[model samples]
Target: MIRGQCLITNKDDQYNDPDVAVILGSDKNPTCESQSVLMAPKIKLSSGYDMPILGFGTYNLNGYQCLTAIHSAVESGYRHFDTAFNHENERQIGEALRTQIQMGNVSRENIFLTTKLWNIHHDPRDVRRICEHQLNLLGFEYIDLYLMQFPVGYRHMCDEILTPINDISVLTTDVDYVDTWRAMEELVKLGLVRSIGLSNFNMEQIQRIIQCSSSKPVVNQIEIWPGFMQKDLVDYCRYNGIVVTAFAPLGQPNREKHTPIYFFSEGMKRLVKKYKRSAAQIVLRYLVDYGVIPIPKAGNPLHIKENLKIFDFKLEEIDIRALRGIKSKERLVQYENIKNHKFYPFERED
Candidate 1:
């Protein structure tokens, strides 16, 4: 096993970094200050911690690829990271951060790392143990944001704790999400985590957590894009002082195979030509204008830089409206297997 801060991976397997440094602002954009690099802007959470408006999402990234992506994100000036225990890459993410610190590329204090408690580990008695296990895997003292990945709680098998199985037959715990939230509140008091939040929860679930907990969830990470805006949920979270985070910010990458192309809507194309930015950047900026943080994942050097460039440009009010006009019923990341679970949150017809 890799010990301390050292990474255990083959040198030949390392991800390629082009070593090209783009200033925060290109000369063509006179409105941008050329002196500053294009790092993501931070927004203050209800918990009083500052979270970057854009973060690198480490979902489905693993092993050397995970390490490489993490390194590239840090090198590209990304300070916030979003990962989950269920993603199964916390060790690689942690190793990458430790490697970068060792190389003087970045420091721990400067990075905002987030991970979640898996549904199986939501048992109140096992919450601390789960958090400690994540800390050990991450090799960090405290996680910046710790979230309950889902409202569904399962009875974790002792033998399967180390190797989590994804079968529905595994019985669920007698625990409820509110009890889990109470236990999560204790995690904050213990100094193991800086902030606590929810993911994949609907309005009622979030409200329940808010009402029951001593420490409120500062942010809610959900699947949001132009098509499946979840406008009502977003508005509710805003009205309630909870920040909204968009996962799959660019829509599901492979969605084109099953759905019609919505990326290049006539309105989006117009904005792309007017602003000289990618369609992806325009959509991300759209969410940002609505006070939502988008965590778009990418490992390529150019793609990573392109995703960060959204902050340098502002979409006019007219353009924002035009882009928001595009509509469809495309909701990705639906956990249909657990829809019957008592805590499943997407049941509302609204």
Candidate 2:
């Protein structure tokens, strides 16, 4: 039997609960092989909502591919779905989610749905409109969590004018993130969302938001992987009562030139043999051990199942220490296009 302690955050920002523990075993584990991975525990957010420590990410996936992957993910026992308006796959995810709910696979209440407010709509007047547009696309009553996709605000109103790449035509907006955050806070008040959070924001930016907004950001979704540990920022978020969710946990294997699978070196081979798990699983377990939620995007059903199987085992603290020793601070998802924007995050370190 493997014993693991669940981390619960109280109002004071403490992440400990010695009184609560879970054992991974046959009787306690569900019979279905896929459902067995649902044993992954939930972490309570400051918003009083519990989110699964592991979430299925929907990025760079579109149309039928995204729909199929989401449907497969739910069948594989994933309860959390992470998407963004910028991802352009929300409609597909929404359709898949609705279909699953109708088919009795999972309910909206049980799934943690997250979407972001694109930077184009950062203007206070545009926030609600973009959010409502996403709502209509999602076909949902209320979003579980809404986040600002990036700190840099853009002035483009039409989708055709906005492009992911840097274009002189796409101008930066004068609207501040503080104003956007406050508008996001209104989302909670209007019952349009359960919680509001941040994504792609750095430490100083997060501090400014906290100081200026009425509602504290419940989470910060950033690029985190075995190679890019981001210890300082992760520490700051944890200490400040914000849950950190790691995207690109497997090092974006497809984008090897930009985000190489550095965790698959000779040093990791021993752990792979010891745990009998994939390199991706080991990397994910490392984040979970540090109380950081990891949202790994996997299109293959086997990979999805393997990713969720991390809960069945716990790494020794010594091993975790060694894993942390592998240091490379390369950020994979840095928006180089908007790096020069005044509100651009990652311009400074913690």
Candidate 3:
């Protein structure tokens, strides 16, 4: 028998009981699962706030695409949702959550909902507006966790023209990142948001934030796949009591145009057959083995169900080592630039 204490999510009840755990949400039917696939651990936030490990990802989804995927995610037993105003799918996401709750699929309290403040909203004042708008549009009374999308931001000050005499230096004057986090921290204090976090930050940046802020970041969500996995970062966060959330947990959709998945490559694919699992399963299992929470997105009910099938099996130590050895460390989605924005904040060796 698995020795750890286990608890199930109770949507009708607040997680006042420290013994209770939150289940992660992904694509799957909450009511059905193979007997072998044990139910997920109690889901809750890193700050000891309620959160589900198997949450839904809303990046790059829109219109009916966003709606249907969210519908399937809810059906698939997902109670945690990760979305943002930039995604522009908040209305659909809100509607889906409300509809499912009304139909008795889940209670509002059972869900761990997260939304982000885009880079453009870096001003402390703008952060409040953006977060409040997200809450209103998504129709959630309060957001569980709110993250600052990135550390970089700028105002309307024009510095494109460089003149020796004028000496226009690129100094930050808009909403400083530190200011934004303070605002997010205020949200937590006000109970408008349960916890606060960072997304797309490197080690140096995270440390900087921790050094200057009154509120510590509880979670750090970033891209993680075998190809681009950041093991050191994940381990560091765990040691520091910060939960790491893996986005683009599978090879990102940008790489869907490529050949075999990183997990399905000759080395790992053979392991999949050995383990009797799919390539996606191998990748997800790899993440879980590392103690990182993965948010993989898919709309197909079958795919959603397949993802939830993970709890049934455990990867062997040797197999886990072998998967770790397959290292291309490829980042499938690094921003070159968005709109007219010209900046890159990732460590890449090309």
Name the best candidate (by TM-score). 2
- Tens-place lDDT digits, model 1, residues 221-296: 9999877888899999999989999999878656447343567456656778999998878888888877799999
Q: Please, what is the TM-score per model?
A: 0.85, 0.87, 0.81
Q: Which stretches of candidate 3 lie over 4 Å from their true place?
A: 1-39, 43-46, 154-174, 253-261, 338-344, 348-350
lDDT of each: 0.78, 0.79, 0.69
Per-residue lDDT tens digits for candidate 2, residues 185-226, read 998999999999999888999999888767789999988887
Q: What is the lDDT of candidate 3?
A: 0.69
Instruction: Name the weakest run of 10 consecutive residues (lDDT summed) in model 2.
Output: 1-10
Per-residue CA lDDT of model 3 for 99-199, tens digit only, reads 87776556677677888877666778767766777888888879988888777664533222111122443333445677788888888777788889988
Model 3 superposed RMSD (Cα)? 7.3
Q: How far in Å is the alpha carbon of 41 misplaced in model 1?
A: 1.2
lDDT preference between candidates 2 and 3, better one: 2
Per-residue lDDT, model 3, residue 214, is 78
Better of 1 and 2 by TM-score: 2
Candidate 1 Cα errors over 4 Å, as ranges: 1-36, 158-170, 255-260, 348-350
